[model samples]
Target: MAIEYIEGDLIASGEEVVVHGCNTRGGFDTGFAGVVKKRHPAALDAYMEYHRNGGLVLGSVIWAYDGRLIGNALTQPTYGRAGKHISYAAVEACMQSIDDAARNGVPGTPFSGGFTRVSMPLIGADRGGGDWNEIERIVETTLKSVKTVVYVLPGHRPSADALSSRPRR
Candidate 1:
């Protein structure tokens, strides 16, 4: 019905499609996208290929699957010092695409498990530099047709031993 916020790893959330906001410039070198990139290099490769093909438009989506289905939303242009790189409109459009693909069917990317549940971190908030309230609103309206799981990381900071192994997005 509504979005469900749970504390855990978005990478291991196990939803049919894991949605996350990414830059349109095609660099997954840092932040949540970085973690996704590290976990699924194929996803970055897919995005790069898509980028070269001129599909990396703002407000567009790229479906990536390398053992896990990832809905890479082109919601921003670049990273680095920024006020708000995240485009709320782009986020909305991306979410709509994911909802449509899950509820209906995306031509080439056939989703398994009927695409019932989708998970994401607080996309565009921490790294993308977006307001959580607005991002939440956008997703709420766009993904009403499917189950949305918003994964919030626990409060405790990871120790040095666990730093190298933490999953961000």
Candidate 2:
């Protein structure tokens, strides 16, 4: 149950799992998903394929295995539509992703067992129109019992500095 903050790229954070907030339709059009799509097309493809096959749903998580670049991706649905307002369910989805990673290894690799640490951007706050205070509270509460160390990436806005500096619960 440890948390650390580092001001850098979430994809380059070197954690076992990198979590991204995605839409239910599996579109990586912007934000961290766009970076992932550009850097690891294969992983993004797999995620979309899974979504196309009815694998992704709100409040659930799916993994995208990318070899070593960032270990693996844990995609959680933050909203059903791209520009819709976010809900507290996004927090549940994030917690579920962490729990899933702890149970299932990094999706396709045998060498890596389970995630010991995870890096994530501020879920639901960027494009999902969520309040940072509420999202932060939800994150801290949900991750309280988990043993994995979580690294939350700051958003690319002026207020991100204030958000990142919030004390971990």
Candidate 3:
């Protein structure tokens, strides 16, 4: 299936992805399945914690630092809440999670044997304040080899299909 890009409210349909404006407040809405927070460990942790607790992890630190669900992709623990940098070790760990997930399928679901659909927001956009292209490169490279479908939720318009087409560099 091709990746579809739609614009509206993130929480409206519990879509696989929801892009945020510069100052979007992650609220409780089933329209969007997840919110892409700018890369801050605390902020990310809060989002994860909220969701894991069955509260709201759309936009916060608790979720960012709390570790990520091993769904279709493996996510690394957020690093550098104090210093504004993504740790190398953390990156490796995160990549490994993706690898692990790709190999064995997510812990709970039955293994489909191929193609795990994973939707992720571009990391390091907010807190790291880095270039989107560079970050996209990192994400692309990390996830390229896996049999995973990445939902590249960027800005006003991100292509789920285009992301799927990007060959591993």
Best by TM-score, which number?
A: 1
What would you estimate as the lDDT of candidate 3? Answer: 0.36
lDDT tens string, model 3, 1-169?
Answer: 2323333333323433122211123332221112433322334454445546765312221212112332211122232224333333333445555544555654333432423444444444433344445545554566554533334434433454554456644
Clashes of each: 0, 0, 29
Question: In candidate 3, where is summed lDDT lowest over 10 consecutive residues?
Answer: 57-66
Q: Which candidate number would show the highest lDDT if scored against the true structure?
A: 1
User: Model 3, which residues run further than 4 Å from truth?
Assistant: 1-83, 109-115, 145-169
Q: Tens-digit lDDT track for model 2 on 7-109?
A: 5576665654566666765667777678878877766776778778987666655555656423223333443445545657756656765655555655556
lDDT of 2: 0.59
Better of 1 and 2 by TM-score: 1
Would you estimate the TM-scores of all the predictions? 0.85, 0.73, 0.41
Residue pairs with clashing backbones, model 2: none
Write one digit per residue (lDDT tens) for candidate 1, span 20-110: 8889886788877889889988789889998899878998888878777888889897766567889898898899888887877655555
